[model samples]
Target: MPRFGSWLLAVCFFVSGGAFAGTTCPNFFIAGSAPTLDASLLSRTTEVCHTEYVLFASGVTKGPLYSAEHLTAAQIAGANSISRSGSWHQETGIPTADRSQSSDYTNSGYDRGHMTPAGDASTLTSEGETFSMANVVPQLHKLNAGEWEKIENYVRNIATQQGEVYVVTGPAFDPTTIPTIGKDNVAVPAYTWKAVYEPGVGAAAFLCTNADNYTCAVVSVDDVKTMSGVDPFPALSATMKSNPIGLTLP
Candidate 1:
């Protein structure tokens, strides 16, 4: 595991404010790397999304930490849906490329599917803001709107029960990546994970994938203890943290 100092350093870089051209998340850390965009062009943007996951620059459609594939700023800006506006669309537009090449896999398919659903953020606008594309990924519709959605709701319940919680979610990047979209435009994912932290309450994370029949294995984060019958996502040496500002739930 990474020492606390190293973890702190990584977190500092993310919330440093200036590192991302006046954009910052309370406590930021790299979830994973995908395709990248032009830093120069992104640096010009002042738009910032307040989310536990990705953060963005003013003019940049995505955050510096994310990698964009075939998506463009114009497409992202124009593709907004009434279903996702106001506080609900804050950190929504995290740039991601449609490497899937599915004809139906336009930027809209990659709509900022809430890892932490809008219901969780009913208390604050920042929670709604976190729903923008800057915080989304090219998720399969079934997973995004199905089992994964249930898990998000569960986490929200946990947060409400616990008073406050820290949740970090993102894609798992690897060489043998899952086929994002089939030739027919069907979307897919090899696996996905959501890590939840509640400081003194209790910490746990869950890993699920299409390959696993979408059954989630919830593991305790308080200790390194593993859960039986549950598969673990690739473990990171460092513990990921996010800024907790603007996250107060009603």
Candidate 2:
């Protein structure tokens, strides 16, 4: 894994509106291979690593395209022992013009939703890092607190039962038009999805619309890739992507 200090330095040199392809943070990806984003998302997007997760932050959307984690049962136990630290803040490593500020979400009627939920962090520091603006998106209050929250907990329960799992959570936007909130133009995604891969089992995803009357569905990993323009498990077999085991929704 690359040193966090070096990653911070690398982020400092990012040119505004430039594409950051070939960006990789292996520690947070499944099989040490990072997800590939569509060419259109490359510009103004860079990989940002945290203690418990890694995300590709998009300057255009002023939020993460996705946040990923290799979660273990032991880590979940550790996380359960720690209290949440609600210290939401902007990522200073990213250029000010390219990142969202906490103030931007103020009174925006949207919640600063976390792609990597705080409940997944195993320490106070990790939990705090999950609150970074780069790891957040503008989500409807009902969705964030309702179905989305259920999905997060469900993922954690699987990690506990299966010993470990690779999880990816992100927002999906429409190509033609994307709604926005706040001064930074943080994207209000039409949909948000969470995908999980268990080593001995199969891979599946939960797709949810970001609305007051939100509905969620169990889908294949390939379905997530097609919609979000990101293939989270590139190393997996075609069968794994094609046939997903049904994960019961809470």
The candidate that achieves the highest TM-score relative to the unseen native structure = 2
Task: For model 1, give the 10-residue run with minimal summed lDDT.
Answer: 224-233
lDDT of each: 0.37, 0.81
**How many Å off is the CA of 231 in candidate 1?**
18
Cα lDDT for residue 147, candidate 2:
86
Worst ten in a row by lDDT for model 2: 7-16
lDDT of 2 by residue, 128-234 (tens): 88989898888899989998898899889999999999998998876556878877788888778898999889898887878888878887877777677777787
Q: Summarize candidate 1's per-residue lDDT along 152-219 as a digit string, tens digits.
A: 66655555566554555534322233344324332333345565655454345554554323455553
- What shift in Å separates residue 141 of candidate 1 from its native position after superposition? 2.7
Candidate 1 C-alpha error for residue 245, in Å: 24
TM-score of each: 0.47, 0.90
Task: Kindly report which residue stretches of model 2 are placed more than 4 angstroms away from their true locations once superposed.
Answer: 1-24
| Candidate with maximal lDDT | 2
